[model samples]
Target: MPAATRHLARRFGASQIALNTKMTIETIYIARHVDIYASSAGYRMNWVTDDWQSVTGLPRDPPLAEYGLSQAQELADYFLSLPEEERPTIMLSSPYYRCLQTAVPTAQKLGLPLYVEHGLSEWYSPVAPGTGLHPRPASAAELRTYFPEIDESWQSIYYPSRKGEDVEQVHDRANGFLRALIPYIEHKFGGKHKRVLLVSHAATVIALTHELIGDRNLPLRVGCCTLTELQRKPGETELIGAWERKRLADGSHLKDGATREWGLEDIIVINDTGLPGTENAADSPVGLQVDLLPPEVLAHV
Candidate 1:
C-alpha cells in the first residue's frame, strides 16, 4: 500500500534537513537470499511441513546437520568481513530454513541471539503439493504418511498455512511487526535518521517502509544482498514511502557513457528509480549532499 500524501508534510521537520551532520546509530537488516536449494527443487512457495522438510531436509533445530553447520560458518565469514560497526542489533530471518540457516552464521558473527519476527518472514505464493521437489504423494493416504514429528507439525501454531498465516497474513504481520521497531530505530539513529543493510523479498520491505515513511508514491527498487545505505536529516521524517517517485541508488540515472552505469544497484528497482533509496530520486543533490560517497566509491573504502 502507498503512504498517504498528508504525511508528506512531516518529511521535512521545522529545521532544514537538507543540511545537518548528525551521527546516527544504525540497524542493519541484511536481506539475504543466499542460494541454498538446488534449482531442480522446483516451485515450493507455500510449502507445508512435509514439503519444507523435503526441500530443506530437517532444518537444524538446535542440533543442526553438518552441512547446515558448514553453511552457517561460511555465511558468518561473509558477515564478519564487513565493517564491525555495520553489525545489526537484531539478527532476523524470514522463518525459512535457508534464511534461518543463513542467519545461524550471521548470529555467530554478530554475537547476538536470532530474533524471529514474523514480519521478516517470506511471502507465500502457494506451492502446488506434487509440483515440489518432494513430489507430493499421489493420494491423501500417502500424503498423510509422515514421521510423527512431521505429523505433529501439521497442527503446529507456527506453521505458515494455519489460517492466520497466509500470504495476506504475511503482509499484515510484516507491517505490524516492523511498526514495533520504529521507536527503537528512531532512538538508534538519534531521531529520524537512516541506516543500511540487506533484505530478502521485494514486497514486504516496500510495504513496511512505505507505511513507515508515508510515501504513497514510493516505487521500491531493492534487490537481494546488494549493499545499500540510507542517511536522513535529523528533523526530516525517517526513510519511508517514496517507492514511487525516486530511485535509491546514487547513480541510478548514470548517462550514456555505458561504462559509467550504475552496477548491482538494486539489480532493477521495482519502480523507475530502480531503487527505493536516494540513488534514483530527484533529490540527487540532497542525497549526494549527505551521502558523500557513491556506492561504487565506497566499495574500495
Candidate 2:
C-alpha cells in the first residue's frame, strides 16, 4: 500500500520532486567518510580538526588522513572496476572536509557532479570541547576554495548550533533528507542516472538506515569508508524488506581488515600554525593535499 502510494506520486506529479518520466533507480550507496581519527583522549577522537586548518590555512574542518585518502582511492578503484551502469549517476557529500575528500577520488574518476549537502553533516554537540562525539564544520567559502567542483551557490539545509543535535533529531533529519532526495533522483535522472552516492558521517548513515529499514537504532556498524547499499524498486512501499536487510552490502571492496587507531602519545607538533596539539600527527601536507589520480582518471581530467 505504501509502495503503491509512493509509485503513484512518482507516476503523477503529486510530489515536490517530479519523476524523471522514465527512470528507475536500482541501487543507492550511502557511505561513511574515510578515517579522520588522529589522536584520542578518554572517550573521543579529536577528529584531527586542526590538521586541515593548518594545511589549507582555511577554517577548522578535519581533513582525511593519509590512510583515509588511500581508502577513498580504493573505493574509486572498486567503483571504476564495476560495470558502467552501476556507477553513481550523481555524487553528494556531507559539508565536512573528510566526507568531501572521500568523494574526491570517485568524483574525479567518474567525472560525476558533486554537491555539498548540509543535512549530511556530522552530528553536532553543544557539549564542552573535551568530548569526542561532535564535529565543527568548515564554512562554505572555505570548502569551495578547496573543492571548486562543488556548485558555488549551494547552501546547507542542516544548520548546527553550539550544542549539537541529539540522536532523535539526527534520525528525523536523515529520514526527511532521504524522503526528499530519493524522489528527486528518480525524477531528475530516472533512466540515465539511477545510482546515487552519498558520503556522510557514521551517526547520520545509521540514522538513514533506521529510516529505510523502519528500525530504531539498528545495530548495524559502519567502518570507516564503509559502503552500505539499499534498493528501491518500482512499486515497493518501504524498499523491499526481509530480503532487503539480508541483501544490504557493507564494505565489500575494502581489503583492509582493521582500521587505523591512534593514541595521544603518537601525536606530533608541525608548527605554530598547525592545530595546537596535532602538529605532525597525520601525514605530511605533501600526502594529504595531493590527489594521485589513477591512470584511467588522468585521461579525463
Candidate 3:
C-alpha cells in the first residue's frame, strides 16, 4: 500500500476497534466550468452559439476566453488558499476542452492527477436534422496532447454527439459517477473525510445535487465556476444520507468583500425557482445566494 493508504489503514483499524463499524465519510465537491466565449461567432445563453457555421463559418470547440481563464485562475487560487487537508485529493473533469482547461491550473498547482470523465460533459443539444449544428468534443488523443498531465489510463464512456440529455438522464449519469466512488473511497481512506473534486458542466452538476438530496429544490441555477459540496458515508442507509451544501454558484472568492474585482459579473439571476425569495424578479440584482445554512438546516434537507 502507498504511504497515505497505509496511514489511513492504521487509523481505520484503530477507529474500527473503537467504533466497531465503518463511518466512511466521503465529501464530494462539484464545480462548474468557468467562462467560455466564441472566437469569431457570438455566444448565446453563455455558450458558443451552436450555429457556428452561420457566423464564424468555422468548426470550433470553444476554449476559455481570456476572462474565463482569469476566473479559472482565481478559482485555482481559492482552492490553493484552503488548508492542505481541506483541499481535494482527487480531481475529475469533463473531457471537454473547457472543463479540462478549468481543471488544469488547479491540478498543476496541487499535483493531483486529472481524470477525464465523459459523463461530466456539457448537456448536449440535438440540432435540426442535417443542420450540422451538432457540437462534438475534441478527441482524447488531442486532449492528452494538450493536457499532458491528464490520466489516460481511465476510459471515457461518453461519445461526442449532438443529442441532448434530459434532466433525468443527467441525474442518472451523476448517480453512476457517485456510486462508482464507493469502493475507491473505502479502500483509499476508510472512515476518514476525503474530498473528491469534479469539474463539470452546469446541468450535470445541478443534476448531481438533485441525485444526492433526492430533491429538485436547488436554490438557483448553477453558473460558471460555481462550487457545490455534498457529503455522505459509504454503505449508509439512504434515510439518514446526510449532505452539506457549502456554496452554490458563488464566485465571491474571486473578489474582495467590499469591491467586486476579477471581472465578476451577475449574468444569471435566480428567481421563482423555489428559492427563498420566489417573488423576487427574475432579473433581481441581489442574485442567487449561496446556501451557507447552519448544519442543522443542511441535515434537515
Q: Evaluated with TM-score, which candidate comes out highest?
A: 2
Give one digit per residue, the lDDT tens place, for model 3 in 128-245: 3333333445545657877897987655533333434445555555665554343334444444546788898777777677776666655457656767777764465442334656
Question: Per-prediction count of colliding residue pairs?
Answer: 26, 13, 0
TM-scores for all candidates: the values are 0.42, 0.66, 0.63
Would you list the rank order by TM-score, best first?
2, 3, 1
Residues 1-301, candidate 2, lDDT per residue (tens digit)? 2453454456544443232334355677887878734321111123544323434543445456666777788899988999997788788888777788889889889987678877687764334343322334566677778887776454443443323555666676776566545544454443456677888877777777767777764566666777877766456644313114423336667766324332122323221122344322432221111132221111111
Minimal lDDT window, size 10, model 2: 286-295
Once superposed on the true structure, which residue ranges of model 1 sit more than 4 Å away at CA?
A: 1-25, 36-75, 125-173, 184-202, 209-228, 237-301
Write candidate 1's Cα lDDT for 1-301 as tens digits.
1232222224543232221223243343434333322122221223212333333333221222343344345556655776865555544444444455555556656665454433454443443332321111111122223211111121111113211233344445444444334433343335543333433344555444445445534555543222223333345433333122222422111111111111222342221111223222231111111133222111111
The per-prediction CA RMSD against the true structure, in angstroms, equals 16.3, 12.1, 13.7
Off by over 4 Å in 2: 1-23, 36-60, 126-142, 153-162, 188-192, 237-243, 246-249, 258-301
Worst 10 residues of 1 by lDDT: 148-157
**Candidate 3, pairs of clashing residues:** none
Winner by lDDT: 2
What's the residue-level lDDT of 54 in candidate 2?
38
